[model samples]
Target: MYSQQVIDHFNNPRNQGRMENPDGVGKVGNPVCGDVMYIYIKVKDDVIQDISWETMGCAAAIATSSMISELAKGKTLDEAEKITRGDVADALQGLPSVKMHCSNLAADGLRKAIEDYRNRRGMA
Candidate 1:
């Protein structure tokens, strides 16, 4: 069973799209679940100015992607990096045990994006 928050996010995902000239991007997939996600971010002055995602996944994956976008926006790079899988799951009011990996992928994708951003700037 999905939580109300999860249903809301899945029904109306936030920031779900390709970004224009993203400062960084991350791609992740679960071969077993066939859930793939591409996270994109635009940074300004070491802060996340904007965030978005394109995901091929189920309701849990989609909701996690949506939640991470909301969590990352307006956060400084360090703050965004601190967002964890538990944070995404908590924000969504928790996910089913079997679907927990969806949150893990979401967090990993965002972290990867930040890493990519830092790497591009020689800050990694």
Candidate 2:
């Protein structure tokens, strides 16, 4: 089962698709569950000006992806780096235990993307 917001997000995820000239990009997946997620970010002056994601998973995955994108937008690299799986899960309210990995996946995607950005810009 899923929350109303999760269902809504799953059906109409915000910040879906991709970003052109993204400052950073991350791709991660859980092979056991076959859930894959990718995150794209566009940053300026160390601030995340835009974010987007693409995921191939269940409702929880979709919800987490959408929520992460929203949370990452307007955040600085340092701010976004501090975001954790608990933050993603709390943002979505709650998720099925089996689907908890989706939240972690989202967080990992964001973190990796930010790290990629930092490495590219010599900020890491």
Candidate 3:
């Protein structure tokens, strides 16, 4: 079963799309579930000015991706990088035990995006 927030996000996910000329992009996949997620971010002054995602996954994956974008947008790179799987799950009100890894993918994707940005900017 999914939480209300999860259902809400799954049904009407936020920031669900791709970005053109993104400062960073991250892609993650779960072979076990065949779930794939791509996260795009635009950074400005070390802050996440915009964020979006495209996910081919279950309800939990979609919800977690959507939640990660919301949580990361407008946050500084360090702040966004600090967002954990628990943070994504908590934002969604919690995910099913079996689907918890979806949250990990979401968080990892975002962190990877930030890392990409940093690396590209010679900050890494």
Candidate 4:
């Protein structure tokens, strides 16, 4: 069963869209669950100015993706990079044991986006 936070996010996912001319984009998929997540970010002065995502998976995946955007937006790259899968799961009041991997994808997607931004800017 899903928590209320999970249900809320799943029913009304936030940042569920694509970004135009994003500074970075990250896409990741879980073959086991056939879940795919795409995260886009825009940075200004090393801070995440905006963030969004597109996900194809179960409710947990959608909820996790939504939560990651909220957690990362307005955060500096270093701060956002520190957001872990446990943090995301906690933010959602915890996900089902079987669905925990969804959180990993969400966190990984965000980190990947930040890395992409850094690499594009020659910072990595």
Model 2 lDDT per residue over 1-124, tens place = 7888788888889999978889999888966777889999999999999999989888888899999999989999899989988888888787888778644589999999998998998978
Question: Where does candidate 3 clash, by residue pair?
Answer: none
Count clashing pairs, candidate 1: 0
Candidate 3 has a TM-score of: 0.95
Query: Which residue pairs collide in model 1, if any?
Result: none
lDDT of 2 at 18: 72
What's the CA RMSD for each of the models? 1.2, 1.4, 1.3, 1.2
For each candidate, what TM-score against the reference? Answer: 0.95, 0.93, 0.95, 0.95
- In model 3, the Cα lDDT at residue 86 comes to 92
Considering summed lDDT, which 10 consecutive residues are worst modelled in model 2? Answer: 95-104
lDDT agreement with native, every candidate: 0.92, 0.87, 0.90, 0.92
* Backbone N/Cα/C clashes per model: 0, 0, 0, 0
Per residue, candidate 4 scores C-alpha lDDT tens digits across 29-117 of: 86676799999999999999999999998888899999999999999999999999999999999999988864458999999999999
lDDT of 1: 0.92
lDDT of 3 by residue, 25-94 (tens): 9989965767999999999999999999999888888899999999998999999999999989988888
Quality of model 3 by C-alpha lDDT? 0.90
**Tens digits of per-residue lDDT for model 1, 1-124:** 9999999999999999999999999999866767999999999999999999999988999999999999999999999999999999999999999889654489999999999999999998
Worst 10 residues of 1 by lDDT: 98-107
